[model samples]
Target chain A: MNLAFAEIQETIRMVQMESLDIRTVTMGINLRDCADSDFEKMNTRVFEKITSYAAKLKETAEQVEKEYGIPIINKRISITPIAEILGNATVEQAVELAKTLDRAAKELGVDFIGGYSALVHKGITKGDQTLLDALPEALSTTERVCASISVATTRTGINMDAVRQMGEIIKKASELTKDRNGIACAKLVVFCNPVEDNPFMAGAFHGSGEGEAVINVGVSGPGVVLNALKRHPDADLGQVADVIKKTAFKITRAGELLGRIVAERLEVPFGIMDLSLAPTNAMNDSVAEILEEIGLERVGTHGTIAALALMNDAVKKGGAMASSYVGGLSGAFIPVSEDNGMIRGIMDDALTLSKLEAMTCVCSVGLDMIALTGEVSAATLSAMIADEAAIGMINKKTTAVRVIPVPGKKEGEMVEFGGLLGRAPVMGVNPFSSDRFVSRGGRIPAPLQSLIN
Target chain B: MSQKRAVVSVIGKDQVGIIAKVTTILADNHINVLDISQTILQDFFTMMMLVDVSELEDLEELQTAFDKVSNELGLKINIQLEEIFQSMHRV
Candidate 1:
């Protein structure tokens, strides 16, 4: 009711020229009830439930986009983690289930369907073990299915067994799709303390605690924030933070409005609006560039973490103010492949794997969309996952790893994932191996932070 | 009842008859202009019109109508629901 007339043109300019967008409107549909002892029946039930529930998802999103004049970039679906429903499932049955999910997603016009996943942070169940065993093949054969695993949490600590196995799983998945630059690994993420209702792909899933079906929205606008910063180039850090907060507020508001309308139209409960500053490969839509605009010459140079932390905090504060429900990994996403500036940072030797690991401590997600040399050992991958998990567990924040080891690819070579997945130059990992350490497959006990209760 | 309104924004090089042409199209679609403002900054023109689209029978038609004006005048015109601006910039 209090919309100012003066703000109209500015908002339009943000959309038209600054690349502001509702990054994704993901429908999280619980598939737990679709399970059955008969695998074929179970698959059919899963397909029917998803197709019926999300039949109108793309149409409604397009209608909303046309009505509001805001681009709803991706309309996707997340389901209840398949492992939870596939107890006593065989490896072949698990693969079939993944294919079912992929087929259902394609039928519903959804780009990606997540939750081909398992949660084994504390211990692996029979279903989780089977799903993990089949994950590599399941992901390679399916075109639209994504898989995620949670192997650590603050309360229970890191599960070294699952961590070590994921290293091998990623290797096999990468080998299976070596023809496509190991794109299969791009659809998989390993997490410590994964969120219940994230709307972002390769990580989103319908948490067991969620209701029958829900709609979650992810809003992204690094360009909007950059434009705000450019307006006050002479402003101090405090003023810079203020500008980012204000810009985030406006972006989150638009996302919330779009989410509510889409949910209402679909007759699904509105989940949460994730206000992460996700970037694409396009120019001027990069989070690393936003960091550089904040007085840093290079993204991985000194003071980069401090600048990133400030921007992440400001984005959350501003986004939290705009939406009543703010959840998911709501901060700045620094995926190297998905963001052009991050790619440039690597190409210029301004960023490295070690520095990216350090930056994950302050950002939303961890070590996302990073490709390493083909010869990097599985134990090293496990060690990397352990490091990121330790950061998340100690800080009690959500952190994940989506690293791909492209076969026959080395540093200084480009791997093109195409579309929103973008492309990246293979970054070198440390030459030293963590084999002996990773081979000790035992739990890393929870830190003192877990004793908060 | 809540009023259904939309903000129709236009931006391009400064030219004659912009307002007249835009208003004529809105009138053709039975849209009533609630408020409007225009300004010129260094040969560039920008205009914002808050109009009641409650009587709008077809959103697609209205969009095509605006597209026709935009194509003919070499301007970028956008029609967005008022709730978007209210939710974004306002508390």
Candidate 2:
């Protein structure tokens, strides 16, 4: 490939100045064969399988990084959902399994290990119920383990019972980790129409249909898009979309190459690339900044949703043009704590929880990394999940809730999670209770969009 | 076939011996320069070199040599494998 010098300079500038990097290269390891009647035996098998499969993950990723000069920020592992392996397990046993997964992650030197999860969109099985009951203990006791529960799907609709249960779980998780500013809640996510091949946490899992092992890459480059937009400040909205699409294509192509290299070295199958504009706390590298680049005075203002819709759609279009197999929640992520612009928007009173919810209608992830008041009732939290699930279920998009209820913290207080998780200001929540609505336990039927099949 | 190539980029204030010093390091390592271009963007000099590194066995050694030159010249020098550029910019 005889790439032009200008193109080479542009790619270098994107990396050196614009924070373009491979956000994650998550290896999906299927642990279905590790299940056994004895939990101890199963744990041993799980450890052996993971350590053997990912033994060279960190080293290979570093080698590739040094060779290509591309920063691969995270090396992670996503296993098959633990609930599938823990059939009829007690809550104590489930927590022990979560610890095993955590130990494997620590030993392998990966950042995070996902798949402490249960799918209850249709209904909760025995294994799903046990995992749900033990989510608080599991999350609080582990450092690197992430837990997700899919409470709604396009076909099965919303499971209000699971949604209601999740609210209590989130509260308990926050309370258990209260000393750490309710950080355990950051590891748990409530999802609607969750994808199986997502490389990003806290919602990634190996999925039932995946092979024995696969490698998925998540690409992040919001700063590149913002810089491109700044170069053409006078361009109209249509031209703005064109710029975003081109930038996203480049980002996706780089991500696909990285994923292929990692997978080839590990001798694993190459999985999909997630083209999400995942933001870090770093200045200028934020999805919210990209929104502001589109001429919005603030990220949560009146025209924010329309701006986000254009950006998200253009990103998908561009990524599709570059890669043959693009999957996961591939769009702009608006996680409040992880985005400096979003945090500033909230601090300036320009962004609020309700406005964030409205913005999620056009974005990829929903209510991500948001902090809420401790006094927010479990019923209200459940109602928030239900509303987000309704949006995902009706619109046929992936949406999730990773809201943290910082215990003993009121509005205007900040919850510092440190590092890439970042710090979040505790935003005010609606005081009115939704106890009666959530108490009516049943599934919300799928909408008309689900009838396309 | 796409030959294995590397791109050596240098950027800093326009000064003497920027290209000479970088190309010398490349030449000593048995790496062949395929294409070279430089432009001064209002006193900030930028040069990009596409070099074939098929003969170079140890990548780290070349990197260390470049690092030394970067320190001596006080310029930001980066050597990236060409696949990164090709993949990012080409279909």
Q: Score the docking of each candidate (DockQ).
A: 0.65, 0.65
Which segments of candidate 1 are over 4 A away from where they belong?
A: A1-5, A450-453
lDDT of 1 by residue, A89-166 (tens): 799999989999999999999899999999999999999999999999999999999899999999999999999999
Query: How far is each candidate from the true structure, as Cα RMSD in Å?
Result: 1.6, 1.7
lDDT tens string, model 2, A167-207?
A: 99999999999999889999999999899999999999999
| Candidate 2: residue A351 lDDT (0-100) | 90
